[model samples]
Every structure is written in C-alpha cells, then in structure tokens.
Target: MSVVMADEAKDVHTEQLAACVRYVPPEDLKVVAQTYDGAPVMSGSVRGVQAHFREKHPQAVYVHCYAPDLNLVLCHTCKAIPEASDFFNLLENLFVSQCVYSQHDQFASIQEELHIEQRELVQISNTRWSCQLSSVNALMKNFPAVMKSLQKIRTPTALALHSKLSKLPVVYLFVVFKKLLGITEGFHKVLQKENVDLAQVVHYKSAVHDTLVSQGTAQVAEEIYAKAKAACRENNIHESSLGPRRKQKMGDFVVEVSCGSRSDLLNDSEHLKQRLFYPCINRMTSELENHFPNVEKEVMIGIQACLPASETFLCMQSLEKLASQYNIQLVPEEVMVTKSFLSRKGTEAISDILSVFKPLNPMMFPSLKTILQVTLTIPDSSCERSFSSLC
Candidate 1:
C-alpha cells in the first residue's frame, strides 16, 4: 500500500514515487504494473511519474482505473441530455436533502405512516456515478411516501418541491432514469469485480454501448414512448403536448415539424420521446464509444497473442514490441525458436503452465519465461479494489 500526496508540480508526483521506490531496495523490487485514476494518468502530473518509473522499471504496465473511467463516461454522457442532467440534479436535492440528511426524519415519518421500510437516500458524488443508482433506487422505492410527505408539509419550500415532483414530466423522468441506471448499474458493478481483466472490461464496454444503441432504434424508441404515455395515463398526470417543434436547417432550407394537423397530446409525447429517451441512449452510446476507443481492443488482442497456449499467439513483430516494452532485447531466432516450441507443446492450459514457470529453470527459455512472467503477473481491477478498501 502506497500513499502519494498530490501537488500541482509535474516533478512532485515523480519525486514522491521515486521516494517510495527508494524505500524498497533496487534488487528486491519487481513492479509488474501501476494502476491509477484516469484523470491524473491522462491529463495530470502523474504522466511524469509514469514516465520516470517506466524508465527504471520497464516491465511495469500502466493501467487506467476501470471504475473511474466508466463513472466519468456516464457523467459526461448524462450531460448531453437536458432531462438526464436535470434529473440527476433534482434527484441529488431530493435524495440528499429530503431522504438522507436535512429532512430525513420527516421522510422516515412518512414512510412509517405508509407502512413501508425506512430507507435513506444515497448521496451523489462528483467522481462516482454508481451512487446515482442508489439514489434513484431510493427515490423509486419510497416515491409514494416522498409524495405524501411533500403534500402534507405546510412549508413553502416543500410545497414548491412537491408541485415539481407531482408533475408528469418529473415522475416520468424518474421512471426513465431508474430504468436506464438500473442497466448501467450492472455494467458499473461488472467493471469493479476483482477478477475482471482488461479483456473483460473491453468486452463489457462494447456490449453496453451496443445495447444502448439498440435501444435507440426507431421501433424501440416508439415502444419506450408508448410506455411513458401509458404511465402518464395511469397516473392521470396531464402533460402538455403542444410545444416547440424540432427543427433542422440545411443549406438555407428550413425544415421543421408541422404539428398543426397532429393531435397536440401525441405531438407533445413525441417531443418528450425525442428530448428524453432517444437522445439519452444515443448520447450514452456515443460517449462510451468515444471514451473507450478501439485501441483498447487492439491492445487486448496483442496481449492475448503473448499467451503461450494461444494458437494465434505472438508473431515476430509483436514479440519484438513486447520485448522492447519489458526492456528484454530478443534476437529474431530466439523469438522464432520460442514460438516453434510453444506451437508444439503449448496445448496445456495457460494457468497450469504459468504455475510451473517460476519453479522451472529460467535459463532453459529466458525470453519465453521473461515474457510469460510479465504478461501473467499483470494485475486486474487492482485500482478499484485498492480504492474500495481505502473507502
């Protein structure tokens, strides 16, 4: 466990890391990987730390924290839709103020009166998007009690907030985000699993975005709008249908929706669908694709090729690159010989082979053994697990 005190200076991060590494003697230390938060690793002074450390420890792989990356993706994607952004802000106030701290007793009293379990709202965090899921669940679970509490309160603030919460848009947004976050919450949890590797993380990222894109399809969009309208009807909440029609300007030609002949209520629902559901899904899919690029896929594919058991494993170019990365100078013939040997005898499971590598003679296959140790010893979800313990 290492504690790094962050400062603005670029050298400060590198100095602290070097100081820590100094504590452990040169001959005794073998750093396999370094996992850190994405922001500092990508844009902050930690870049210097990584560069300096890699100069001394060439085998160390730097991995961005998976959990924080996913959280950041969600936060950025949420900002693309006005409803989602507002939903989170409103939910933050409702959860943090009403259910968690300020008026928690009032909220609990209402829940008690309604004969429901007393549950507190989860507080939102700027850096952790998963907390939003807990907040949404708390809201949906105790919604009835929340409404009753607001209605019974005589204060102006409560009444104003109640007025907003009682509206069809607010309630509909609540339900929609609850459903959306429910899906995202699962993805978030999967990324934080101790056993999850970069390959699995990349797979989950692709699957999640693909699912979001599928949800934005026309048929699915209509189904979602229908559900929202049905919920509105069931609740007897009258939502406006006549509003500003969506417009598109193309090369001095103005194109706008002519809602003149259409039913106002239907047009309104369509507007709501366009504003809330479809855009949210599209934005999430786009943001995820943008944040988690195909380079990760390429990197994972390259790493998999280093596995001895893989039939499609390491080529000459890949072997050279891997060797260069770990500061292992390999002759072309050595790589070819290793590849030939593995092709003939690498049928054994990778884990079983790796377990025997250390005890076996390293001098027998120096290049193969060195590469295997580096690739196999790479940590998975270490950053998230470490952060969890700290919290």
Candidate 2:
C-alpha cells in the first residue's frame, strides 16, 4: 500500500509487459523462429515485441498472464523468461503443486494450536461445573423424602445456589439451578395451590433492570459530553492556551498518551492526577528475600487506588503517611488542564510525592528493621542495663 511499493510494482510489471516476446506453436515456428539459415525470419522480430506492448498497453502490464489462476499476470519475458509457452505451462503447474504442498505442511500446525487453546477453555469450564453437577445429583436423590418439607430446604438454599449459578459459564448450570431451586421455591404453589403471579412480577422486574442497563451507557454518555462542555466554559479558560516552559529533573517521568478518541476519558492532564482509581489487592514485591536477599523482587503486589472524587485528596494524604511510616520516598504531581506548549503537567506535585515515598518502601520491611536492631543491641548487655539504671 505504500507509494514506494506501488511504484516498484508498476515498474516491474511495465518492464515485464514491454519485454514480452512472441511465442508460436512448434509447427508454426518455421515462419516465426527461423528462416533457411536457422535465424529469426524478420530482422525486427525480437525487439519489435517490446515496442508493440509499450504502444498498445502503455498503462499496465498484461503479458505472460495466467487466465487459469484467475490472475492477470504471473510470468513475463522481462523477468521469468521462457523459451516457449509450453515451458511456461510446465513451470506454472510445478509452482502451484509446490504451493499446495507447503500449505499441507502448515495445516497441521494451525489445527494443533487451535486444539490446545480450545482444550484449555473446556478444562476450565469442566472443573468449575463438576462441583455444581454433583450437588444437584445429591439434591435429586433427597427430593421424594423431603417432599412435605421441601419448602424448608428450598427457599434460602435455592436463592443462594441461584446467586452462585449466575457466575457459571455453562447453560446447563443455569437450567439445573432453575429446576432444583424451583423444586425448592415453587413448593408452596405446588402443595398449597396458590397463584404464581408474584413470581412473574419478579421476572418482570429483572427484565426491566436488564433493559435499563442496556440503555444506561448511551444515556450517561450524552450527560458526560454536556458536563465537559460546561466545565470547559466555567473555568474562564480559553480553548487554547500559551503557557511557559516546564523544568524537569532526572528520574522524573510522565506517561504520554496521544488521546485520539479517548481524550474525554482524561479528566486531567497532570502527571499524577487521580481519576477513577479502582482498589486492587497488593501483595509482596519479593519472596525469597527473607532467606537469601533478592529473590522477592519477582513477587507482584496489589495496591488500592483512591476514587469517588472526594477520596482523591484523602488517598494522596494516606499515600504520603504510608510512605513516611515505612520511610518510602514518593513524588506526587498535579494535573494539566490546558492546551499549552510549555506547561509541565503537574511536575511539582509528582516530585513532592516521589520524594516522600522513596525512602519509606525499602525500610518498611520487618526483617531489615529487625536485623538493624539486633546489630545495634550492643556486646555488653549488663553494662548497658547498669548505665540505663543510673540514668
């Protein structure tokens, strides 16, 4: 699709089409290929073919084309020169045969990878569903004995089972959950002969919820755009800005995103401006550091991010406090809200955050602190205790 490649293709094709020499059947070659002295019959026969194609088909190459392959051109006298048309026929057939053979070799590999991926999906579903099926089978065996008191076992337990069934991917799990839980929940209607209109109402309510959710995103999207427009106007800021230059230091970093369509998702352009931060579980950054020293670096930890608008400031303060308690250095930065060539995006805030937390993280470890404490415990405990008593 590139211009260079297109030009090359045209050049190659034009050259090949122009160079296409005439081919005659073996019986007709007497008048074409040679005269009495076994030389070409006409003086201009060889070079004239190039001139003929250039004049007639000046726009594109068409010589040595393959009608059988549904392709316009496969070979031409400019590149893959053939002594005769019969020679080209043989070569084209061989090429197709080799192509089919290569495809056959690759077919098995493609199928094998697909099979492995499919098996992983199947195994994941099967193991998770096995527990559900076993429980259902046990429930079926107790059905007749508990027919009178089925209402007792059905309500609370069935609702709980229904909640769990929602997570399962299998359709049969949903069917079984419905059937067994119905046998438990629907016992009142079956035994006492009351109306099931209330149950139908619940189904209608569920349908309404799903319908609202399906349309919720589009409705919210309209309001979001209106809010953005209002905010842009209220700040008393121009649509365009001309700010001064930013000054940064070593180790200062920012994530650059060319927000083509996602510009609206960016609430602020600052270095560390808190957005909709989701809480995630934080774990150890390392493991074997306890035994040797550095093996714990491989561990991944989960951390909570502040969200809900009001909590952004609280989370920032908590982050600073947490860093200080552990002697971790942190650098926090502000948000960039203007279209300026020179403004550094909240650099000062980010720098302050990073500085506060940088020292705390490494020193927070219990083992490191214990090691330091033991080392400073002193060689003479008796003299140290006596000196402390005097004090």
Candidate 3:
C-alpha cells in the first residue's frame, strides 16, 4: 500500500519493494504474496524485480494481477481482427471530435431533438476493458443522434465520420463488440472490486470463459448481424453491398474469385460473420484460457476450496494440499472440528471467519488462523486503483 517514484528499472523496483517490506516490524514481517502488473521490469522471469525479491523471501508467491491480465486478454483478443482495431480507433476519433465546446453543444442539441438523453462520449481505454464497454455502449445508444449531428456540421471530418458510421461493416462490428463486451462486463467488474479474492476470481473467470464459448456459434453471429441491420434501418442508412472479388495468387498467376454475390445482403452478413465475428469470439475464448492458466493450478484450486463462499468449502483434500504447499502444519482432526463449528455459522467473508476465533485462545487452531490471515493479504486491484488515483 505504498507508491514510490523512481527510475523504471528492475533494480529500482526491487529496492523499493524491499524498503516497503522492511518498514514492517521485524517480528510481524511476512510477504505471503507479491502482486504486480506485467511490466517487463516487474514481471520478467529471470532478471525481473519479482525474481530478485524472491531470493530474499522465497515464501512470497508471485502473482500477476488479474485486472491487468484481463485487460491483456481483451487487448490481444481484439487484435485478432483488423476491423476491431479500426472500430476502436473510430470510437476514439468520435470522442475527440466532440471535445470542442461548440461541437459538444451541437451534438447535445441533436440528442434533444431525437429524444435521446444527452450523454458525453466515453473514450476507449487500452488498459481498462470496462471503459471500452462504456464507450461502445454510449456510441450505440447515441448512434442516430450522432449521424444527425455529423450531417448538420458539413465539415470534412464530420463527413468522413458520417460515411464510416453509415457503412454496414462498421455497424456490424458495433453489434459484435456490444455483445462481446457485454458478456465480459460482469467478469471485468468482479476482478476490479476492492474485496475480490481468489474464490471470486476463479468463479467469474470460468463463467466468462463458458459464456464466450457458448456464444461463438454462427447462429449467434447471424442474430448479431440482424441487430446491426435493424440499427442501420433505424438511422435511415442503406446497407452497403459486399466488396469486390478477392484476388488470389495461384502458381504466380493472379486469379480473381468472387467471394459472394455482391448484391446479396444476406451473403454479405454471412461473409462478415465468418471473417470477423466468429474469429473474434474464438480468439477471446483462447486468450482467456492462455492468460488465466494459473487459476487452475493446484495451489489456487486449494485456495478456492478453502474459502467459505466456495461450493467446496473446507474440502479436506484441498485443505491438506494448501497446507502442504505453504508448509503450514495443521492437525486434521482439530481443523475438522473448527470446520464443523464454522459450517453452522455460514460466514461468507474471511474477516467474519477470523472474528469467530477472537473469543477463543490464540493457540487454538493457530495454523488455520495463519492461513486465513495470508488469504486476506492477497491483493486484488487495490494497488492498481492507488496508481490510478495518482493520475
């Protein structure tokens, strides 16, 4: 819970982190976990700050913060399609273009005329998926009003933006991301919460992974296109036909092949689904699996099983595994006695469980208390939030 300004180097971070740990009293100092962002200086495996620090404190397990990992999952997943990159850039351009006082006033008036609530456009953030979701939602809700504002301005930039928004591909991408980000919004919020723990993280991570997998079908893509088409009609924008035939290279001779009938909007929608929508969904699910493999590790599984909120709370095998991994000696019979008492209380939070032992002897179930204390010390997004406040 400290921030220090220094050169962004591995040695500097190692020194600062050590200083922070030393600030604690010698008898009470115990670094159970070290959570950090994926910066090269901090997370680089061999020569990184985390590695250097672990030499002095071998018990400190390194954890890459879930919030930033989730952000990377989204940032990389969106890169699966060229159109997604352009789509987010367009959102930024739209937000920046309206920053002028007169332009914002004009857009606000247009919203009033269209019976849409006046709302400021949200700029997409690379490190914050929630902000990206908000930006997409804001643009989607204000689509008609934005088109009218662009038409009234008669400026080159406005005209360009108007043309881009009126296109079938852009609108289709809009629909695709709306659903994608909507599915991610819940998991994103859970990761960013102040009190979030390993148990909640595991739950929501699996939930989002399953949801993305379930929604990757061609039927879902077609439904998304239908929504996009309806949005185009609502704004009085005619759907554009598919692009020209794609040129192919065969034995050094260029051959032009028709992708589909250019006049068929249904064919165009199918092409967009195959090319963009399904790939985006598939890439997202893959990234989730790649970035969060640690959640399935034995130690993490044991941690989740120990939490009262978990369905498998107080699982004996998991508890033993956790104790062994951390080298905490626990008497199984005594632990089960505590578990039996806690099962009746049904406490949801680590703090509540700790409170139940306040009246008992300090030596009673000492290992269980130590486990809970270490669990409580595991960081979530609090450090990230603190850094954000500095900005």
Candidate 4:
C-alpha cells in the first residue's frame, strides 16, 4: 500500500502518504491506522509521525511493531556480549564454509558417524533472531561431530580452528546462549502468530518476565557449567586449564593442566561463571525488560473503556482517560447498558463483545459500536514481515 523513498524527512514522507490517502476514494478508504517499526524516525522524539498523522487523519491511530522492537533489543544485546558476538560470527563462517558448500558432505558423514540426525546448519540473517538461534542449536546438537569433521579435514586452517573451538571460554558461551536463544525463539514465535490476541500479548509478556526472574545468576551459571562439562565428556575432549603460575628466574611461569580433574576444578568453574556466564544472562534479561516496557497498563485501560467486558486489571481512571483520548461521551445510561450486557455475557472477549453489539441498532447503541471497532482492532507486528517480503 506504500512506496519506499530515499527522502526520510517526516514532512516529505507524511505528505506522500497523505496524498496516497487522498487519491483513494473516500468510501473505500475507511479506518486508516498505520503500523510501523518503533524507530525514532517513525515515532521520533515528541513531534513525530504519530503526532502528524493524528492531526491530519483524525480517526487514524499509530501502532508500533512489538516483535521488531524486541528483535532490535536482542541485536544490541549480541553486540554488548562480545563472546556471544564472536560465537555468532563463528556460526556464520561455519555455515558458509561447511554447511552450505565445500565441506557439507564431511559434516554429514561425521553426523552419521556420531549417530546424530543429519541436520543441515541454519543460515543466519541480519534481521532474524530465529535464524541465529537455529544455527546455534544445530552447532550445539552436532558439536562433537563438527569437531571430529574438522579434525578429519586434514588442513592446517581446519586444525587451527579446531584448537580455537576447544577452549573452555568458547564452549561455555555456546552452551549458555544456546539455552537463552531457545527461550527467546519461543517468545518470538508466540508474538508473530496470526491468532495472537490483545490479552495474550499482556499475558505472554508477564510470563517471560516471570521466567527470567526465576532464573537467578548463580543457578544459570551452574546450568552452563554442567552443560559444558557434559559436552566435554560426550566429545572425549580434555578440558584444559591454565594451572597455577610459579615464580621463576625469567619472572613467572604458568603450568597448564591437561585434564579438568584438578582439586581446584570447582574454583575454576566458579571463576568462569563469575567472569563470563553471569554478565551475559544479566545483560540479556535487563535489556529485554527495558525494551518490553509495561504497556499493559495503558493497553488494559484503553480496552476496558472500549470493551469493559472484563474486570481483570481494570481501572476507572484508565477508562476515563481512554474515553477522553477517543472523544467518546460515556453517558451513565450507556455505561449501565454496557455493564449489564457484560454481566449477562459473563466476561466475553473483545471480538465476542463486538459480535454481541454488532446486531444492535445504531440509534440505540450510538458510541458502543465505534468503541467496539476501535477496541477490537489490535495492532499487529506481521506488517513488518509483509513489508520485508515485498522488499
């Protein structure tokens, strides 16, 4: 319905959009709401497209794409955790060289040898977190097979890469992020579903928050170490450690521990957990919380005013404010009728509320139908996916 242009100036963009709206016949162009990425340019500062659109198209409402915003948050978080960024880079390189082209046969052979499924590695995309996650999961599932494949390559570069991959730091990060990404990927799928409802959006956000809250740093660190140890055992790879350093004539010499069976193994585990494991988990959770703010309050308020079918999380102030925002006059008799209908219906959903009142005469219901239309129209994030497809 829209065209992309190089000029991103708000006035120019909005002007073009306004022209398009004008070009459409008045009867056909009904309920013009815009759904866009939640970037500064679109919802820029105080005076942005949201404001401009409101002024021009009085009935139009602006909605931000929730999933894309969450994706952006994860994108920034990847940058924040250097180890994770490096691991993701490794996954991309592995995918291109081994998964896609040259050594794919070798990888498949190794997977067969290891008695694992012959799954192809996922290709990573800049915009898709799910891609990154699937890539990580493939790597984790076939880590031993992948390492064995590299060893069988009989190339200096492959051998050197194998050496780098054996390090504890890399392995620990791989395991930690693998679990975290699994959680996030689930959330992403739920948000992008077609039947996703307004109440479910609020419900899922709380569920994610609670899940993150339940996973404490120490517990997460423990889980990471356990997984890393299991991977080491399964692969028959010796987990080496930089053992104690002793004073020498040359200054100091550090001894290397070949097997991770030393008395200070617990100490080593704790040290790694403190240094690397805890920080990344904290960063991701904090960033997620910051990005997914409690829009539930305002959303519930608005819904209650329009639908007023459910009493859960309802506030009178929110109802009044929402009414003012939509310029709807909430007469006492109308409120009584709405509440009485709800009482008989026994707390119906927004869609059901709309259907219930749809058959009623407009003269008798007046503002109720308008409220139902506005309230039932939940903002969707699927527009971004559709736009990406067109591009």
**In every candidate, how many clashes are there?**
1, 35, 0, 0
lDDT of 1 by residue, 1-391 (tens): 1212121213323422212221111122567556554444532434666556667765555654566666766688667665577668777766645743546777788888879898877777765668877887887777777777777665677776776665556666666666677767778887766544444455567777777766676676566566655655654456665455567787987877554433222335566677667777777777787666322333355455564444446566665665666566666676566656555554553333244244434576667666555554443433344334233
Q: Candidates' TM-scores?
A: 0.68, 0.14, 0.83, 0.75
Taking every candidate in turn, the Cα RMSD to the unseen true structure, in Å, is: 7.7, 40.4, 5.3, 6.7
Q: Please, what is the whole-model Cα lDDT of each candidate in the order they appear?
A: 0.59, 0.24, 0.71, 0.61
Instruction: Write one digit per residue (lDDT tens) for candidate 4, span 278-378.
Output: 76667777877766643335544666444333454224455555556567775557655755665565544434444544554557666655454555454
Ranked by lDDT from best down, the candidates are: 3, 4, 1, 2
Candidate 1 vs. truth: CA RMSD? 7.7
Q: How many backbone clashes does candidate 2 have?
A: 35
Across residues 253-357, which tens digit of lDDT does each residue of candidate 2 receive? 653434342222222322101211100000000111111111011110001111111123224454343334323344443211111211334434322222222
Answer with 1 or 4, whichever has the higher lDDT: 4
lDDT of 2: 0.24
Q: Which stretches of candidate 1 lie over 4 Å from their true place?
A: 1-32, 39-47, 57-61, 99-106, 112-117, 245-267, 293-298, 304-324, 327-372, 380-391
Error of 2 at 66 (Å): 59
Lowest lDDT block of 10, candidate 3: 17-26
User: Which candidate comes out best when scored by lDDT?
Assistant: 3
